[model samples]
Target: MCVVLAALLAFELFQPAHAQIPNAAQGYQRELTRVVQQEWGMNGRVAVHAAQIHQESAWRSNVNSPVGAQGLSQFMPSTSAWIAEIYPDLGRAAPYSPGWAMRAQARYNKWHWQQLASAADECQRWAFALSAYNGGLGWVNRDRRLATAAGDNPRVWFGSVEKYTHRAGWALRENRHYVRHILLTLTPRYERAGWQGGAPCNA
Candidate 1:
């Protein structure tokens, strides 16, 4: 009995593989939390990214950009197709299916994040990856190099790269909203976890 109980406990700790895919707005928050946690090394970072996604699309699974982006993560159709290639069955399936789109986007995000492994163990890595996820990695890389050369503080996002890309202005504004939403919603839990971004407002 004890062994069976232990196995159940272990199973309970992991979310279902499908937990990262959500169809309803109500479920997106939970699924986003799971995805962020899966992709990000830290819980706090996951919370932050989840908030960002909320800010960007309000958890809309079929959101389409005026320019051609599609799906929950607002991936360009080509990018979505590329991500779909990673899953053979999915490549044959509809790219706009909520579950397929979510999986593809998550895989793409994970790939993008991995490209910055040099920034491992640093919050800036998360920040930079988020920037690249919104903008493009090529632009973010240019900014990173310039910022590094100028002796700028590269640890925190300061909108320094906005000048480099026209898309960045909107991306920066959206990311700021993302940070705010996450901070507001998760502040209580983060504080309880000893969050240092600020003193607990309630305590």
Candidate 2:
């Protein structure tokens, strides 16, 4: 009886909280899959991207944040315009269009990932990339510099660079939560649900 109880407790501890995928996420899976593959190749972190979209707008294509971020990917107007301008193939800035938003998000993630080559590992790199996505790459760089000055390893994220942020309290909290929620929480959930491209942090 004790052994059986221990096994049940272990199962409960290992099980994911909210393991079921959101219904709204179902409609965009195909498009997201294609965009992630197109941008990051076949082994792209599709589950991570899906979790990002879930965090951004909960797969709602028509929602808008009070801060003016719009649509499924929750891009601000200026950012949408900038992304479209820099990547001409993306054409006009249409944050409301599901197809456009998915592609733009995938492209933008690739862009950030490419710039964060100094991270200690893929997990650290993606944490920085996601932080850059939530806040800005400038903030990530600034925090890394601060971390270095404090004698911490700037290449690491968890207890290193994440502890050296200079942003406002609210901004810092949101940015940290955004990175953790997407990478540690939601990414694993999506991976277990059979989304392609396994979680990087888990890898």
RMSD of candidates 1 onward, in order: 12.0, 5.3
The local distance difference test score of model 1 is: 0.52
Q: Please, what are the lDDT tens digits per residue for candidate 1 over residues 1-203?
A: 12432453344335342333224544655554465455444443544444444545556766777877776667776666666676665565344566665555566667776887765234445556666776678867776666566765444343333323334467657654443333334333333333223211121
lDDT winner among the candidates? 2
Model 2 CA deviation exceeding 4 Å by range: 1-13, 16-20
User: In candidate 2, what residue range of length 10 has the lowest lDDT sum?
Assistant: 1-10
Query: What TM-score do all the candidates reach, one by one?
Result: 0.60, 0.92
Tens-digit lDDT track for model 2 on 35-77? 9998989998899999999999999999999999999999999
Model 1 segments more than 4 A misplaced:
1-24, 29-49, 87-90, 93-95, 153-203
lDDT accuracy of residue 24 in candidate 2 = 82
Candidate 2 at residue 41, lDDT? 91
